[model samples]
Target chain A: MSLFHPTGPRVGSLLSGSIRQAAMTVARRDHGTPSESDGAPASTVVEARTSGPSAAPSLGPSFRSSEVIRVEHLAVSYRRSDGAEVRAVEDVSFSVREGEFVTLIGPSGCGKTSLLRVMGGLLRPAAGQVYVNDVLVKGPMPDAIAYVFQDFALFPWRTARANVEIALQLKRVPRGERRRRALDALDMVGLAEVADRFPRELSGGMQQRLAVARALVSNCGILLLDEPFGALDEQTRLVLGVQLSQLLESAGRTIVFVTHSLQEAVFLSDRILVLSHQPCRIKKTVEVPLPRPRGPDQVKSPAGQRIEAELFQLLYRESLV
Target chain B: MRIRPASLAEAYVEVGPVRRAPWWSPAGGRARLRGALRGRRLRVFLLRWATVLALIGVYEAITRLFFAGSLFLPPASEIFTRGMGVFVEEGVPEALQTTAVEYGIAFAVATLIGLSCGAALGAIPGARGVGRDLLQVLMALPQIAIYPIIILFFGIGPGAKIVFGVTHGVFPIMLSTMSGVGEVEETLPRAIRAMGGGWVAVTWRAVLPSALPSVLTGLRVGAKTCLLGVLLAELLSSVNGTGALVMMYSANGRIPQLYALTLGICVGAFAVNTLMTVVERRLTRWRG
Candidate 1:
């Protein structure tokens, strides 16, 4: 029985069976390699499809790279306006391989954005540690990472090109290179024509692309996107999602995307981490086995539908809780 | 809901659709011009003016007909006819020049000092509370009652008027600037910081633009207050200007000249307000 098929037993049982299979597959892959059994290879091990009662689709070969990010026992809390302490995220652990695309998906207020913020060093976790390429994330390391906010947080006063140029200026990139790189990033996002236009002059979707341009032009190895396409209309969202997938494919940078939309996650991610409600815990990690260079045709494939249905089921169950 | 075409037709007749003509048509252009002229807002403004004119006419009639023997009440026409001549009198003109100089100097000094101090206080939380309380105290003080002391110190020249004006104008600007900078949204500063902006960048890019509209508002308030301060000083001890001219006409029982000078002061205030409004509009165009 396929774990993703709707005809399976309750989603929880399917999820448990898949997790067990993934664990066994990871154990076998680790046994083959001479690497130490410190759960490090498990972070990069791609789960294999097996003949079992809860067989999941096989993930492709792993992209070999050292861990770019390692988050361990992370917990975050905030004081409410009424002075009550509310824990947003608690004891969540995950790691991402270099050049990999990992996504975090859950219902609203599940603290996916909070976890991304912790990784980006924008918000300090109450407990546990986040390591970026072996160094602890004490503050925003502009050289190592860049963040794209959901609201297309471009400076309203600046033109699109200027917005992209800002990060380069901060890094003290040479004047000519700054201009070239900024233009190049805008070109990637198909916003070269609107480079001189202010944020107000462009549509909401265009503004988000400009934000992506800004992040990409920084040339940081790790990119954190916090629901970047959440504000767009449905049609615009789909178009931009494909464009983003292509952009990331070319850039080959590690991406950790946070979104509430399951379809978006299934469409863009190599691995989707479903999170439970607040004091959020990672409930399941599903590997997307569909081959990339993904397009509209790939989106309509049987494999895509299966993945989408599985993600939706996980999200629906999470919402009920 | 009744689908009654006849009733709908009757309703349309009672409140006809506004017929819009093509923009390039001669009659259309004329109609647009007339519509612009006869808009509801324009009608309201005209009605207000008509009321004022009628009141003035009644006052003129009462003075000219009912108070024939009285020298204190003069007809409005007589005041209008002689007002410009009195304004051009050598003593009056010199006094007016002195007041203008005093107003300019005081307004400029107060604006600079207030803006700098307020910006510093507002930007630094430690200074904001104490600075605001001190400013409140200054604002609460009776500025006019201190004229005698100002006269004793500055000795009734343009210096005294400038001092008085500064005292009156500085508080509003300071208060406004403090509130303006304080009211800047937190998100803007956070966004700047996320972009790797330091304190200087955040202040220049985010805080300053957000606070500008309020700063302009402060400037307008300061201008009006400075004008009031200048008038107060002149009324108390000035040797020349519109205030001095009013005093002189009143003492000599020149009712018509006094009335005319008062009307001139009203016009001057209106002109100042209109100029400030135009400047404010131009400078704050980026707000939209």
Candidate 2:
């Protein structure tokens, strides 16, 4: 079993009073988006109340809409220093519909990152075709999509707001509009106060959120995040995961994420693509039916546990091979 | 359970509404000003200058009370005055001007050549690896040893000094450019490219800007090395400039004049280093 289990003994004691209270609030409180369909005990959480927040219930069944991104028999390889081609990923096929968060999870060095990069048009597939918005992607499509790098690859020299403005600058957006929109995105991510602060001045989670703000400022339809919170600790990841679900709640953009954490895969993903060892291939696809707002409590619920277990086993077995 | 301590705060500090104190309010304005003025940076600045002045006082005392003649160890006050004397001294002013001109011309040439070469070397991998090895070898060789060959080829005019300065200064700037290019994390350029930003946009916007601080750093080192190189050439071959003046004074046992001339060169180098630092800090103000 992994550490930081919500129901486990250590989680409550390990977390300080405030975080425990926040976690308690998150696990117990429901924004009451969908009706009371949960099979879990009501005593565990306060009675669900119908609350109308700014973000109306996810706009349409964009999940049921046409495939926004698709890959068929996609293969990626790299030439060794000795000049021999070593395959990283092959024969992986998947489709993500509009406004759905699809996560790719696998064993270490399983080419999950390479597969994501290929879809982003960063790395060319050695064989087969990858499509974004039904167009075969040959290079980066920054206008249509934005990639959130694993390391929170923010420019060291730009302020949090300026970093968000980079893509808009490339788009040649008006200066007034760019500054206003950049601040709006930072405000959306709860980083409005740090809009003028440099990246180094902020904490790790703030930097990660700033990166997300940078991606969001352009308002691209598709966001391809390669473990945007990979460098962060488990607590930060949990909070960012919840924040991402809320972001999706409001924005309703198509997301393709690559991560190593099974809990993370199950927590935020509409569907999880589990890949095998090198020469990576999709072994299974698990669809999460836990509804729109999947919080820390939802992740610990029966539905979330079953899917997390399955994902863990798939990755664990692949790693053994 | 080997759980580490909570190295991270799980939540951010609660933020409150911003309230700006009225600028015209005497008590509020004075409080903020005092808080800012008595800050850590100001204290450090004062301490730094205090230490410098104290060291100067100790040196002054030692030279006046313990030292022998003016040729052996001139007083600090005399050195300062004599160092400034090169300005009004008849032929000394011309020689100083010549040295200043030579240094400026050499530095400019070095920067132009170094930047172009570094960008070219960094942009291509086949060249970067080979050039890196070549640079390592060149950096290992003593610059003094190359003086004979350079003077032979270009002669004892501005040509030899310029070439020498370029040779000394170019490597650091080039290496800095190469590393700066390296520092532009691949993700940024890729992100720009993916965002409809073309190659030219990527190079100009992301590549050059990100590498600037590092390139400036290389320039700082290059400037000092160029100064050293030109002066070295002036000393060995040229019959004019500060380097030649120092040699002429030393040969005639004009120790105070030699010391003054050397001090002038030091001050000039310090100015270059300080100016470059200010530029570097301005360009990289966002960095920690």
Candidate 3:
């Protein structure tokens, strides 16, 4: 049996009840009666702490493990101009183990971006659940999740460091700490030298790295990268892919990466999840058996070649469909 | 084909003899200077000036020779002489000062009103269509046609001039401001939101900066319109300013003075346009 029932009324009741109870407590606090003045409410506070909001839905002991994210039965769809609903992702399910690098490889328009958006809580799934540390995500949980977009969406007006600082700012981190963390993140991406330069001044690869730095600086447990290096040339992509692997390994963050390139998937992932075309479903999940601290030569190794070939065939078949 | 030494020499002489000078030598310096003069941007600038000068030359020649001593079509030289006197005249400074004040006030008021209305309308969802249509209708109604109505209300003073100027100036500014805010890139807003910005944050950071270049364009157009409005008011009813001076000279049959005042107004308009253009360029340099 599932530890946290997927469609449990208990979880729903817990969410609503906690919100109501929080509101009531806020009202009582506003009215200025100290908890000690009301002994009954003081006992209620102890109950609220032990059996209240945090206890409502059992996020499962799996969440307590190093693993930071768990997703189940996620579906995303958009209504077309003609009023037809185009389901982008349907019944997609996956989980990221703590400090593991996993990538979703699929053809273009196969809902890779939609999947990442769902992971980041930017889009609410039609009929599924995404749990970050046992809590169901309803909106952007910026404190726990950061996203690196495919297009290297850095603010043109801000310097590379400022772009990273912006994410920290949203989290309400103190100024001195924000800058120091931002600088450290930039240093990890090897963009510390160009910290003062604006996005326009950087090359495509550099800009992508700066975006990675921005995501890293947020100190989120889970990072969702939607084809972060898709726009770069091959040589730059390969170099940056290795750099990213090193950075994430050092940070010990769970990453759910999406990419169109099979080689990139094989190069960076602990496991490669192959997704089908529109209304994308998980076709297969192939565990990448390649050794860690993977380099370019490993990608050329016999095992890497076999994995790439398998992913290619799966992607090619999906495309034909 | 082989050529005899004499024939080669003759050909060289005919074609302009090739100088045995280094690339940066005096001979090469002439060629470089010529090339610089013929560069595309320099050529275009020179062509504009040349056309304006040619038109003035044609007007000066026609008025001097064909007008047959008629004061109405005074020659350019006569206008220049009278223009110098008009500049030195006792009340001319005060008239210029009054026109400057009126133009400045009109431009400032029009810009503020235009930007506020334009931004509010442009940024609102589904309202741009109605706003644009209304603006188009307003723009179609000429400010000149309402001069009598405005004079009735403000009674032919600086107030009327300012009101007239503002009426003329506001539309272009509004339209430009709307266009500027409308053209903010689609990805910019999405990017900001993805980074966890709320509506106000997106507007202040992404939308405003992206719309700045367009705003500058509107301000330039508004500046020109303000100049036009001020002139129209002065010509129609004002007691002072370059426009009133022109009207006084015309009524008095002082054709030379009238032409000089007209020239002065044109120069003033040109100067204001040039200043605004410079400001626009400086402000929008980052857009490229």
Candidate 4:
């Protein structure tokens, strides 16, 4: 749809052959895709992926033209009020190519969110640095990144449309223009009708969708989703997962998602970065050979199962369970 | 005695047969009455008026029958009619004007200082603990005990009343605001920062809006306390203002006139509280 049309240099290549192929798949179905058909098998395939590896050689060089986010030996630590020190992320290094979907999946409280925060410049890393579009990430770079928090950090006092308009307002967009853009963003999320409804009035799934709309309206090249669907039920998660994949297909923005759901990782990611328990480190980077604008049946397919099994085994081993 | 079943269907029934009522029946009428009262706004209005009229009726009855010549408890009708004469009494209007000015200035000053100080204390980590402790200490003090000190500093004029009012009013607002600002979720400010908002934007957009309910609660409490402080100052000084008028009436044993003046004060307090409530509802309409 034109709603996802290129608004900046980042999305300029959205209509290119590869991305169009994905957009076509999205266009073939309505917003509520029939994801229920494969729900059972799709869920069972969670967390299985290829053997331990940094990156698949075959997929390299094809999309390495631009590295939008680079995390170099990034380490994060927190200090307690009682003067105790606790390490969260340790020596984590990775790079995300433009328009790639990278999923950070790990056990609960394993610092995936901490790593995402560091990349978004919401938190200052104790060691190393993050670079977004070649700019050092010492602090928030709203121009380059938009973050969707796990709890759907919506402003309770503002309606859905107003919440979406906040980032634009911060950027000093004209009132009339921001209004239009906000409505358009809400429409894209199928929430145009409830644009005037406060966050508290929305359902859990709708709230998450509204949060996504807010992030989208920012029009940032890099989207950071910290377990955006973690609070949702499994059924809603699957549906939203499918819808998000389609939306990202058309938007063509690089995404760094954090989640604990194996099925979600398998369904939405181009690469799954399995993280170890606290003092988080990248345990393995599994590349999904599955094509973009993934079909509903893909998660239940043999290849998807193979990848999920590998991921599950890796995490199972990492957890020492 | 032995009884036989009327019919097979009746025998199979678990309980006695149901008796349906017609529209004119008492049961049906009562049900309809309940349905009518279910209209929320109408019911609330009726209930409120009923309570007020009942209280006034009882007070009038008791005073007229039992305390017919009582100087301390005059009839409600006299308070409304003869008591209202206090409005036109000499110096009463001037005292009202003085009180109004004092209230307006004190409330405005308290609101501004309370909000700013509260936001600062709440937002600044280093200041939060110390600010909280200081506010607690101030809140704990018997504000009335300082009336003499205020009188000495500002004299018996409106200055003393305003200052006293502010002292009485500012603590609730500051404390409420501090807690309100402090209670704002960490994610909100983080969202603003991620959107490239600096300290100013975070405070204005995130901190202020999020802390508003608490700040408003503080303001409401402060407003009431401030009014009390000013009135008490005037009453104690007994030199000028509405409090002085009240003191004069009571000292002279103008029982009806005193009650009338007291009733007027009650109305004024009610009006102020009502105005605050309306404003609070209007601003927080988004909360719905």
Number of the predicted model whose DockQ against the real structure is largest: 2
**Residue pairs in collision within model 3:** none
Give the per-residue lDDT of model 3 (tens digit) for A256-303.
898988888887877788999888999998877665555666688998
Query: What is the C-alpha lDDT profile of model 2 across A18-60, one tens digit per residue?
Result: 3334334334323321221232322222111111111223324
Weakest 10 consecutive residues of candidate 3 chain B by summed lDDT: B1-10
- Model number with the top lDDT: 4
User: How do the residues A51-92 of candidate 4 rate in per-residue lDDT, one tens digit apiece?
Assistant: 112344523666455678889999999987898999999999
TM-score of chain A in every predicted structure: 0.79, 0.80, 0.79, 0.83
Docking class of 2: acceptable
Distance from true position, residue B129, model 3, in Å? 3.1
Regions of model 4 farther than 4 Å from truth: A1-22, A25-64, B1-38
TM-score against native, each model: 0.72, 0.81, 0.76, 0.85
Q: Is candidate 1 or candidate 4 better by lDDT?
A: 4
TM-score of 3: 0.76
For every model in order, what is the number of clashing pairs? 2, 3, 0, 11
| RMSD, one per candidate, in order | 12.4, 8.4, 17.1, 11.8
Error of 4 at A76 (Å): 1.1
TM-score of chain B of 4: 0.84
lDDT of 1 by residue, A1-321 (tens): 100212323322322333344454335433432321332243233322112102322332342136789899999999998999999998998888765689999889888888998898878899999999889998778878888988867777677898899888877788997888788677656566667766766677677878998887777778999999999888667656765764565455789999988778877877888998988999888887665545555556898889889988988987887
- TM (chain A), candidate 2: 0.80
The DockQ score of candidate 4 comes to: 0.25
lDDT of 1 by residue, B147-264 (tens): 8999999998888888889988888898989988987877667666666777887898788877777888888889889989989888887887668778888999878778877887
True contacts kept of 1: 0.08
The two-chain DockQ for each candidate, comma-separated, is 0.07, 0.30, 0.07, 0.25
Model 4 Cα RMSD, Å?
11.8
